[model samples]
Structure formats: structure tokens, C-alpha cells
Target chain A: MNRDGARSSIDVLERYSGETYGRALLGVYLAAPTVWLVSMYAGHAAAGFAAFLVIFAFGLAMDLALRRSSVVLYDERYERISRKASDAVFNVYGGGGFVVFVSLIALEFLGYYEMTPRVETLFLAWSAFVLSWGVCYTAFKSRA
Target chain B: MKNRLPELREREGISQAELAEAVDVTRQTINSIERERYDPSLELAFELATYFDATVEDIFLYEADEDGV
Candidate 1:
């Protein structure tokens, strides 16, 4: 392998350290405290602790299973492809955000619905952002 | 931007992945160049030329637009 490849591989090795569960340890700890604080602020102080435990365990399990499995060989071509994807993602978020904003305003005016600072709404928003970026990245990568 | 990247790779009897490893790039980059879907940057073009023991022009044939784009 070339010097860059070796360096990148070393980076991957360091990030995961081959102890899969160990990679998730910090995430698991952080998730509990963050979720507990959010839940407690939302008037579910006691429930937060229970939810925290579940989330902590879930994060560890899921991250151990899924994260750091593949080490991507990034190069100039990958960078070029991803730049196109990033441009597309920017457009998607810019245009899509405007549409969503207008739609929400219209819905509120029509008294059909109200956007709230709830977990589900937050998740949905996150899902839209994630899916748009994912789709753009995949499409550009495949096109190339 | 048209190139003989695939032909050169074939002449070398190596996989795109192998060349990519040799040059510290991803196989998809090579595939993209071979397919004419992406153009390589000057640095990469030089690297590829160096790897193939050829000048950049030997691998790539560039035809400018009518308006010289």
C-alpha cells in the first residue's frame, strides 16, 4: 500500500482499536446523561433514569454491531464524488427546508396542526436530513 | 475528458483496486475515470501517468469545447 493508504488504515485501526464494544463505551455513557437530562426537563424525572439505562444498553449494542465495520479507501475520486454529493445535499436542504417551512406555516394558519418540540418531531426532522444526504451521496457515488 | 485508463490497466494486467492501492486511491475513482464519468485532477493525472510510465496525454485525450471551455 502507498503511504497515504497506510496512514489511513492506521487511522481506521486507531479509531476502532479492534475492540468493537470499546468504541461504543463513550457513546453509551453520553447517551444516558443526555437523554436523562432531556427527559427530566420534560417532566419525566423518574422515567428518565429508566429510559437512560435502556438507551445506554441499546447504544452500546447497536454501535458495537454496526459502527466501524468497514474502512473506506478514500481518494481523489471519492473526494470528487462526495463534493458533488455535498453540493446536491446543500440544494436539497436549502430548497426542502424552504418548502417545509412554508408548509408548516400554512398548516399552522389552517389550524390543521402545530409543530412542537417533541421527540418524534425532532426524529422526523433528523430523518429527513439524514435521508436526503444519504440519498444524494449514494446517487452520486453510483453515477460515478 | 476521455481516457484509456481501462486499457492501460488491462495492459498492466492489474485490477483497478490494485492500482488504486498502489496510488492510494479508491477503485471507484479509477472506475470513474475509465468510464469517463469523472476526470482526474492534475495531480492524480500525473500520478496515473507516472504509474503507467506514460505522459498524461498518452492516457487522456482532451477535446476543448467549441467555445474553448
Candidate 2:
């Protein structure tokens, strides 16, 4: 053992600290509503566009904070907390997806949301949920 | 998975915090390693070796029986 008795076999994950993954996830998360907000304000021209810009800036700032806070390799307690949090996030989202899927199937069979926007919302929500969870799983699995 | 990490730590008269700092890791990591729930990377193995002035094998000997755990 080294003087401090730490073994060299432990793998510390330090990958993706750069903004690439964070930006990508943020872009995906913000795209739909930001686009809707922009579209909603399009009739107002400059005022609406300015509002969209402000909202987008706020969204980006939040994203930046999240990315900054996501720095996880330096501290052990933080790492454990992060792992548990990520696992909880994955499980919650996965459960939500399963519930949504079952509901959608039930609705289709029962002819409830056959022609309503409910179906479209389900599709959008499921897509976003799956995509976000996919990224989380990748990030978690890649951690050592 | 079972080894004499605690014994070794006691033998060296080192605290987990001191050992963690010296090894450039968190005390929990050393604790986890001792518990055998996790394995160290080659770099960490080398770090532990260099810290103890011993070979990696001296600190982390592997056993086939332990693998089934």
C-alpha cells in the first residue's frame, strides 16, 4: 500500500467535464418549450422576440448553473450523492415512462385520446423522457 | 473480495483521512475498497503501492474464491 494506503485500482471518472454533454442535454431540454414560446410571441414581432431572447438567456443561465454544479469527481461525498441522485432520477423517469406508456396503450384501446392533443403530448413527453434518461444512463454507466 | 485492509491500516498507524489524502482520494473510497465493494484502477493500485512502498500485490492480492462473492 502507498503511504496513505490507497490502492491504484480505483477508477475515478473525469470524462465530459467540458460543456459538450451539458450543452447537448440543455439544448434538448429547452428546445420544445423555447420554440413554442418563440412561436407564441412571433405575432408581436420585436417585443415577442425580445421576450423569447430573455427567456432563452434565463434558460441558458440555469443550464450553466446545472452544469457547474454537476462537477462530480473531486469529492467523495459529492460523488456518492450524485450517484444516488442520478439513480433516483433514472428510476423516477423510467417509472414515469412506464406509466405513460401503459396509459397511452390503455387510452388507445379505450379510444379516449384518439384524436386529441393528449396523444401528441404523450408522444412528446415520452420522447423527451426517454432521451434524457438515455443520456443519464450513459453518463452513469460510464462513471467508474 | 475479503482482505486485511483494516488490519493493514492499523498496522501502519494511519487514519483513513490521512491515508485518503495521501492517496489523493476520499476516505469513503478507501473504506469502499476495504469493504471490497469496489476495485481500484491501475493508477490507484500504483498510487497505493507507491504510498506503502510495497508492490500492488502486497496490498491487493486477488483470489478466485473471492470473485464469486
Candidate 3:
């Protein structure tokens, strides 16, 4: 066990099959935005689907390249950095989401704007959270 | 949490990547330890000590708290 009762680095490394799930996650991250953009702007299901497939392929290529070249690990340093990033994200998301929520509601009530489907809007909100967290985590991971 | 890892590793003419590989960690983890930005786990400390043929105390040091002093 580790300092915080987490698994030891050796244990973590040994269990990793060199097939980095992080790379797969990075692939998903890359594909999601392209999916979003194509769906929103292209307005054609076939075009959106094509773009999704292509971008996902590109993401997989990038992932394979990274897996082959880099020695990524889920060591203590990663945990520490991830914790800090999560804390920062929470603060940013709470404040920013509140501001946006209030502004949109105010705009809607005042007849300045129209709201879309609630479920889809909530889905977008969740996507924004994921995007913000990925960006912040990567930024802090590199800098720290 | 301060350590003499960099000096010891340098004296042995070892790269961080090499040490990381030996210790089953990422190179960045070793770099972080050297820079005093991260404290290693007891398991890692012991492993590093064993690798360098030294005690943990020889590598890591605990400073007196300034407030207590």
C-alpha cells in the first residue's frame, strides 16, 4: 500500500498491460468534440456520422502513437495532481455554471431568448463539465 | 519530504528515466521527487533506498518545523 493506502507504484505498473486506458480516454475526448461540432453545424445525419467516424479514427491513431512513445503511469504524482485539478474544477464549475444558469434564466424570463429541450440542454451541460475538467486536468498535469 | 535523490542518482550516473524504469514509475515521478514537489510512498522510498544501497534516512530528510523552532 501507499501513503494514503493507495496501491504501490510497482503494483500499479505491474497491473498495467501497456494498453493505456488513458489513451483510449484521450481518443474519446478527441472524438466527442468533433461529434458535437458536426452534429450542431452540419445538420445532416450522414455527414455528422462520417465526421464522427473519421475523427474517431484520428483519435485512435493519436492514442496509438502516444502509447508507443510515452511511459505514462498512474503513480502518486498523478494522483496528487489529479486531486488538485479536481478541486479547482469544482470551484470553477460551481461559480461559472451558476452565473450562466442565472443569466440564461433571466434572459428567458425577460423574453430575450428561448430555451431548448431540457434533456438535451442538460446533456450539453454535462459535456461542458467533462470538457472543462479534461482541459484543466491536462493543463495542471503538464505545468505541475 | 526533502530528498537527496538527484545528487545520488547523478553520482551514480543514472538518468531519471532509468531510475523510474528500475523503480516501476514514470520519469516525471522521479523528477517530481527530486524537485521536492512530491513525497514518495513508503514502498517507493524503500525501493529507492534498496536500489541505491542506502537507508531511507540517507536519501530523505525531515526538517524541523519553523513554527516549533
For residues A12-117, could you state the per-residue lDDT of candidate 1 as single tens digits?
5545322333345656778799989999999998999998989888876655443334323345665677888988987787677667767776888999978777
Q: Name the 10 consecutive residues with the lowest summed lDDT in model 3 chain A.
A: A10-19
Better of 2 and 3 by lDDT: 3
Candidate DockQ values, in order, are 0.26, 0.09, 0.26
Model 3, residue B1: what's the lDDT?
78
DockQ of 2: 0.09
lDDT of 3 at B18: 81
Taking chain A of model 1 alone, its TM-score versus the true chain A equals 0.31
Stretches > 4 Å off in candidate 2: A1-88, A110-123, A132-144, B65-69
Quantify all predictions' global Cα lDDT against the true fold: 0.75, 0.66, 0.75
Give the distance in Å from residue A36's predicted Cα in candidate 1 to where it truly belongs.
18
Superior candidate under TM-score, 2 versus 3? 3
Candidate 1 per-residue lDDT, tens place, B3-67, comes to 98889999999998678767766666777888898898999899999999999999999999999
* lDDT string, candidate 3, A55-132, tens digits: 777766655544444346456677778989978887787666767777887888999977779934874785688687
Per-candidate count of clashing residue pairs (backbone under 3 Å): 0, 18, 0
Misplaced by over 4 Å in model 3 are A1-72, A94-144
Winner on DockQ between 1 and 2 is 1
lDDT of 3 by residue, B1-69 (tens): 799999999999999878987887777789889999888989999999999999999999989898976
